[model samples]
Target chain A: MNKIFEVPLYAYERSSDQDAATAVRHKVIVIGAGPVGLATAIDLAQQGVEVVVLDDNDKVSFGSRAICFSQRTLDIADRLGAGSPMVDKGVQWNVGKVFFDNRQVYEFNLQPDTGYANPAFINLQQYYFENALVDRVRQLQAAGAPIEIRGRNKVEAIGTHDSHVVLEVETPEGPYNVEADWLIACDGANSPTRRMLGLDFDGRVFEDNFLIADVVMEADFPTERWFWFDPPFNRGQSALLHKQPDNVWRIDLQLGWDIDKEREKRPENVIPRLKAMLGEDVDFDLEWVSIYTFQCRRMERFRHGRVLFAGDSAHQVSPFGAMGANSGIQDADNLCWKLKLVLDGKAPEILLDSYSRERVQAADANIAKSSRSTDFITPKSQISRLLRDAVLDLSEHFEFARPLVNSGRLSTPCTYQDSSLSSADALNGPDITRPGSACPDAPLGDEFLLPKLAGKFTLLTIDAGAPERIEEGGVEATRLALSVKDDLTLELKRRYLGDATGAVYLIRPDQHVAARRDTFEENAFRQAIRRATGKE
Target chain B: MADLILTPNLDSADDFYAGLLAAHDGLDKSASDALNARLVLVLANHIGDADVLTQAVKAAALRGS
Candidate 1:
């Protein structure tokens, strides 16, 4: 195996001159051209790894799926080099309104810049986001990485042997076989790749179905997202409306549990629901209306040997906190860097399993968090409904009760505290370990939120002596001298330095703090470097 | 070929399709039927697919009938 650093962007194919059939075998074959697959491909291409991405669709489609891009996702995107454009295009929403009994019960102002770079959340069209990614993918393809986007090509069969995974693809022209060292599946919830591998996607399916509509409003509606319970117009149903780019409005109606399969075919059934939420006088043009069932399930495992899973392929989280695609993109971010190291022969096979372990744990935690959020939003039981209503009632007077009504916790990233990959020593320390605590998006010197620490490994330490020690041991590390303050939180001073104790923290490319040590004692730094880079 | 005039008053014309709009706006069946006949005629003019247009008028008139 070649040294990872020496691996050229298009190692197998000299240039992008050869037809895909005659093209050389790539280092990685990524299935599905969604945000996760594209993001993983972009990250791998940036690292100079030869990649080929394949999808069934000929062109990107406009859909109302995964609109809310959280600050964490923006931070991850920033590392991939498209954060600024996304931020510029998206509407930054920090406040949300929840209405109970047709009245404003709770208003939430999210604590921005508290964790990771970027804001609370931003709303953008998924199709536009896909276009941006497609452009990036095209750029990488032009650079001679052999990113053959076999649009209208479907993978018929994927067979894994000792060396590489063989993909049998049926393209418009003909059937072709392509083999690669690794395969990453970002093919969404109904992933054929996951099924081909015989991995189990087990969990409860929510009985409730939702009708999502994208409408063009003529009237001036509020920019904030509004959630209403037992809306006056529609009893036993909830209405949610969000403003998107352009004059487009995203309205979701919580249709009852049982839905006729042919309900959407009759547009009249869905149209009235939209009118009830928006006043009858308001003139609007319907862009698209579709009925979708919410499901909360995750794969038992994220990988089968060389074949791996990311996004909805791995887990299907109900869109309660917009966790489905956000978590999926994060999964791609986490898996890409590790796969690069392994393919480059920089890391052992054991490191690959950590992706499965850590991310599966993250997915499990995400599933639970999203499920809890779904239950909170649309509780099934009578007692749970009463408890939910009680919170809305109490939030009127209680200051802290607003968070319950607003529920900002849904959007927060789930940490990997009780995962096998996490070191026990790191959890017990003098300094607060944000192991699962998302890397804060605290503002740096200017208005720049601390730059996303993606693409490469990062070392953040309170010990002023650590960088010197790391350099002494032939290991690269960054030392930030932090002053321990009164609050048990990371403090960004007038300077660039942070606030904390004498502990060393190693952050992964996806911005997950992998390993933290109070003192780098007895080859701990080397072990940590191996743990982070998977070289050990 | 003459200049295809696309000019049409969409505002008041919108009220002619009030039943369809009202149905989407979460209105009851009675008010939904009152404007059904006008809704069918207005929508049939807008629909591009002939088969779909036939279905639209038939369904709307059946609801009113």
Candidate 2:
């Protein structure tokens, strides 16, 4: 039985003229109001781009889906101005414990290198995240920014062209024809937009079914990820327990592919399973019960002319490592800035092509990582099972084998190492700020490095030539000559400049390193900026 | 007894990864499996941490049978 999540109905006013033969032209129309779509909308609006989001549902996410928000996701969210609220409400956890057959094998801490802003991961319910993003979008709208989110607005049909994309949106009033300069599809795994366009979404599907249940209880479970392979509670299968906000504990039990999903989801079956794990004396109420068979698949290309696909619409993976939503959010972050640039006509339209290229590569990477996690969690073959056990066994003591332990690899942002936009770096420097990687954050006086470099094309330099005349695309280059006496300053030097005294780095608006050179010549720097913006 | 440093210890990580993958190239599933088994044994012998290896095997051993 599926219980509907109650959300305040948003009374949306229709913008398109039904009487007029032609539709109103919007700068961008984003389909689906899930994390990805909403993130895209919020990002575009932050860039002063007029954007609208359409979704079939009036409420936020039903269950506590995607509870583990990665540090990178939070960093991206904070950049979008929604990070503080989530961090405020979220359960910050970095330590994780992996078990095999009811015995603790090893404990690992993600993002051990400290002095940065955020933790490794935060466990917040998906609903809170969606609500926060929606609130931020509403705030931007109230501030007279061109952003509209229409709940109960569903995309029925989609047509793409070289010039623009057309959409038939079905609302409560009726069907309305609308057109957009570019259409972004974030309509989730079963994206009707992708189906309507007749594009193939190809990937591997695992045979195991995981029973995901969230139960509200006041328990003393520590804020850490607990993963068990063939636990006593669920024999011959794996189980995962994670702490979420509002005292809800997320329990995932591997149910095997042959189990009756309907019977498995019933309160009769679910309560016993929980009781078996948590003991019979404990009391709890089930918040959500769902079964998922994992699949790692994606479209060949995220873009088809003017229509762009993002989030689950573009690629989907097993929810083991919290990769699905995190990658989707990154997809939105990566696309929105580039889309804003192309829309503003500041750069060539080919910049949009890089969005698909980089993100498709990201999707493939996520799929590979997540699929391996899934295979480890639920071993299908005898050899796979044997290998998994061997790795887990060796992981308990040997630090070398510890890396083999895969409890969903945990979501991390993909660095576009092979990105076409990256400039050839002939300079001697550390690989930390390599072209096509997100610029590593370090303390700058009172604030962090990312916040300064974001929202502009920054030519970052540390202990390099004294930048007297700088200013290329939008902002001037930063010359950080802070003495390495400070630990943070030293870390910055080790990461960016390395053993060298100084290195000049070209950074994109998204804070990805576009190029790095020992000395920034005027012509070379200009050419690098142009290439970064898809002018090459 | 020294507390094992849990930080990055390897240099040339990218090259090592490429070599690792390249070593298994052109091999089918079973061959790759055999190779991984041989590699693990070789590495385990190289490590020679009996207590750690024992703890690891014991940790992943099948239970609740």
Model 2: per-residue Cα lDDT over A421-457, one tens digit each = 8888757778767888887777666767677776667
Q: What would the TM-scores of all predictions be?
A: 0.78, 0.86
Candidate 2's displacement at residue A232, Å, is: 3.3
The alpha-carbon interface RMSD of model 2 comes to: 4.8
lDDT by residue for model 1 (A1-536), tens: 53221222221222232346552466888888888988888888888888877777655544556688887788877777777777788886656778776778767766565533466678887765776677677776787764556566688898887778888877656667777888889898889998787778887655467778888886887788888877776566677888888778898777777767476536687677677777787789887777777577787778788888998888886666777778877887778877877776666776777778778877777777766666667767765666566666656656644555533244556576654444445534533345545566544434343463555556665533555335312335554444334223444322223332466666666666667766555367567666565454
> What are the Cα lDDT values of the candidates?
0.67, 0.80
- DockQ by candidate, in order: 0.01, 0.06
Best by TM-score: 2
- Best DockQ among the predictions, by candidate number: 2
Candidate 1: Cα lDDT at A139: 72
Each candidate's fnat, in order?
0.00, 0.00
